[model samples]
Target: MSYMDFPSFSLVGSFYTDPSTMDNDPSHYDESCTNPSPWQDPGGSHFFSFQDILASKPNRAFTPPVVTCAFDQNGNPSLTDPLIGAPVNSTDTPGATNGQTPPFSPAKMVDLDVYQQGVSNIYGFVLKLTVGGTVLTGAMDPCTLNSIRFDRVLPTRGWAGWDSYGWGSFGGDSNACGVYQSVVRIPADTWPAASGSPILDQLRAATTQDTSGNLLLSIRMTLDGYQNVPWHASDFRIGRVLATVGPQLATDPSHCLAGRWLAGRSAGPGDAWDQPSLYGAPFEVKNNTVAIDLSNALMTSAPGQGPLNLGNLSVYIGDGSTGVVGTPFQTNDILYSLSGGIVRLPLTAEQAAAAASAPFFLASSLPGINGLSTFNKQPVLWQESATGFWIACDDRNFQLASDQPNPGSQPGFFYVTQWGQPVTDASQIEHHVFPCFPNNSAATVPWSGGYKGNSLSSDGCLEAVLCPGTHSGQFCLELSAIWDPGSRTPELESQLYFICLWQKGTPPPPPNLESGCPPQEQMMSAVVWSSYQINTKPDWAEIQRLMKVYVKLFPSMHARMDLSDQQTFQIFSTNPPWFVSYANMPGPATYTLPSGGVIASGTIPYYMTRTIDDPRLMPIMRDLSPNRLLTVLYYCYNLQQETQPTPPPPGEGAPHPTATPTRKGANA
Candidate 1:
């Protein structure tokens, strides 16, 4: 049997044989019940004793060796030592020839048993081992065999050291020397090596079309460890640890699949994830029907209908009521529908009650349909019927009816309704009526003395007057008359002529003396007053009267008259007349009449001529008194007497009775 070390005594009693009930115990079992006794079977298929089993298993027990490790000056383990004995070098020998050192030299021993025993006694036994490329050394208690490390490097890359181990000189003693051992185990796998490669590969292939194929092969190995692991149960929390790491590892691939998953699900026969149908289809109840998919039916049909068949239903998914139909009944309407199927329109209670109570069709006809009555007994027909409906007379109808008038007879008055008579063509209706004149026919005369009845002579003096021989007269008449009978009117004669008449001779004068008259009396005749009629035919005086009338008729008329010397008797009517007197005087005539009816004749003496100069005369000779007329005649007589020359008598050489030179006093 192998020796076993019992560290904790709680497991010790199983090794010894039991004293009681020995006959039935395995140690006391019959030889027949045991194969090769209780410890052995034909092929060792029997239960092994605890000690034998311990001996057969690989040595899991750690026994510290008596190690006397020595340090060199650099604090490394030394090969040679004086007090502790040298390590035995297997290559060295004990006996040698020619003074060569022995293989097992006493001073250079590779295995120093004596020093090792001394080391065990001095401190404690210690064990040294190498694991995962790191060296660990531990001291053990002599009784407990438990480890107390002085210097060790763990497989996880942690270190421990002691103050007495020379690790102080290496600057590790302060950190390593503690009651709790400072042990660092180098990890078998690093985070970067385990996770970085897979993560990076997934990220790189995330854009590839065959990411699923690539990712499946790549990630299968990392996840396989948890294939049979139960949730929330493991030593060292391996499953939990893997679970935590799994999501981190899957972040890239999971993110890549997210968009594709959403797109694929959205492209199926259902509403997109972001939208929903608001109305659903009607339900059909039938026997033998199982459950129905309302979500799909809700998507495909109108609201208020439900329980449709799953095959006929569509997926309803999205934000709530996005595709809702039926005019979205208001909250009030919805409440009303829930209560009952009655819809209340927006009518007020009063209006509804009034409408319910009133008789229908009583006021149905339009307003103002009745015929309107005027103040008189006439009906105004303010409303009229068009087809079957009556229309009130609006302002347009009233205005039209007001404008209508009755036909009436035309009055005898000129009415200008259209264009006026054309003033431009008025000359066609013009008439040349004979314009009447006073004292003359309306006959046109030629330039000569005959009447052409159409033309008037240019020389004829025509006066257009308004005197009509009656009150209102004709206008613009021409008259032809001789101006002077003595010669042709001076205006008509261009030449000047002289005329000579016979003068009385003194011969045989006067029939040889008159009765009792003196010889001189017979010769010089007394002045006799003879009335010579100035035959002014065609009566220029009358013409003058007519001209005066003309001037009165037309205030703008003015004329100038000229008379010849031979026609001295021509009367002129002017406010003031210019007169000439023949006296051998250089000035105008001045005469004073004598009182009483006396006639005196004499040549105007030079002394009396001054008295007669510049005499004032009345404009109308008839207006003068007889005394004044006598005075004028007396002046003429006096002027004749004064200028008389002695003439020879009739037979005695005196002037003849009628030959006194006509007693011309002064030509005025």
Candidate 2:
């Protein structure tokens, strides 16, 4: 026999009073089956009343609940009980030798060692009592079993501590009747009911599925016999019920298979991809073996089904990478074309379960092209389209320095493949990538990107600034491909351009350009990195309005800048040295302002400007209000040219970039 280590499954055990069938005895509080604290109790009776265990009250004779099991004349446990914990018609015989049943364990909390290697399904546990009639059996629904969370076992206190207040004795009553239960919380509610002599008084089970859909099973047991049982009165009165619930592994091959499966169509050739083309039905993984039926679409006998066209099928093994292209299977990746559409992977149940959650990134070679050809080499970068699918383009032959749009460039085929599916010609080679932005648009203007000429990068790139005429919460895509003015070869490239979204009342961008243009890029970058939107507005009046919104969102960036009549007028003076100059103040410089000054600065680096070359800043500040003038300073301050550190002599340590003494703003 070999041992395999499976993921640990939790088995929660608890006890609760059944108000309908059992009496509501306030004294019968939740208690543990195994209490360490020494307490006086009758011999062979660990069921000490709550008053004796907790309050040191006089000990009372009490019988703990247990499942009734039959015994033979030889004093050996017997499985003669017709309604054992196993399912109906189950041929499972744990004690086949000499008709002796497995000995019952007295503890309420028991560890169940479930073997998933050869097992298909697990029926309910088999619980037997040390002293009782032939049988006591019943099955409770998963919801009802999981709800009984009393007498829960704690690491420090085994079934001792109660997390809930209601589980304790209520209404000034003190009866010590311990409630013991263990159940699995799973999705199913169809638990088999009891069908035998001496119906079980209490039986609960709960189970939950792991990330891989494996069952974390648990069981609960409660026995009731002998009269005056402080907790409640049961309708069935039997002899002394001395019993305990123990673990019994019941395996059934007729039940549903264990573990999960992820299935999808194999990648098809780009030129002949078809959505209705049947490849295989939903597959199942049993014992780490998967069998996909190919007769459905392959066999001509099946109605309306075409002959099975065997294509390359592969299973995705994401080797710690993300995104489509980066994670796509290379020549080294595992490729599978199961024999007769049936293949078994060498993975344990736990490993197989984890694989089901990830989307399959199937890669297929173009028709007529060698599967391992150089041009068939996977593209270096794959930008996931807005449609949540991937579109592959081959630009190996095209030559260009800057990545930009070249509309009408080449009539190459681009593949649109879904997650975990193979690319076929029917779904591959498409002119459009995404539907018109907002999805409800009348015309479908697919936006494309990641090419040369109208690249997403590069200053003044046409695709970078594309936007719709109107703005709303939904996204819109525009064809940002600028037609070749000189008709320099009809190969113009086009890409989907996501319209730049901006906050309401944002200042208009530079004239003769896209509305939001590059400002929205800076705004979005700042918001994503530091949650601060640096002033990018060019108009002084509009800047004031944008500042109001920014100040409301981030009050900490708010700062007051009061300027005097002389300071206010001379602040923008670059020729004559004013009271504040970049030459004198290398760092933040402060200037005293007269009362009632209208300069309000917030979070903007307080740098005095000596020269203003930026087109956004006006040479003269006399025509502008103090607030508008400050706004110009705020915008220019952030626009300072990013300086790179100069290298030292070869083999010497690199020197840091020297700080420029003149605080001059760069041209936008």
Question: For this target, which candidate reaches the highest lDDT against the unseen true structure?
Answer: 2
TM-score of 1: 0.09
Off by over 4 Å in 2: 1-542, 552-668
Q: Ten consecutive residues with minimal summed lDDT in candidate 1?
A: 393-402
Q: List, residue by residue over 1-107, the lDDT tens digit for candidate 1.
A: 00000000000101100011111121121223222122111111111011222223353221111112222222222333321221211111112334534222111
Lowest summed lDDT over 10 consecutive residues: which window, candidate 2?
Answer: 111-120
lDDT of 1: 0.17
Each prediction's RMSD over C-alphas, in Å, is: 83.3, 31.1
lDDT of 2 by residue, 1-668 (tens): 00001111111111211111011111111122122221111111111111112122344332233222322222233344432332211111111223445232111111010000000111222232221332222221111111111111111211222322213323111111111233222222222333232222112122233354333333322122122223322311111211122222123100111122232232223312221122222233335533332212121112111232223434433331432222223221011111212232344454455444443223344343222212234311111112223322111011111112322221121122333232333312212221112221111111121112222222232232222212111121232323322211111111112122222233433332222232111111100000112243454344444333222221222222222122332232212222112223222222222221111122232223212211112211111223333445544332321222222334646322233222111101
Residue 557 displacement in candidate 2 (angstroms): 5.3
Q: lDDT scores for all predictions?
A: 0.17, 0.23
- Please count the clashing residue pairs in each candidate, in the order shown: 52, 48
- 266: Cα error in model 1, Å: 99
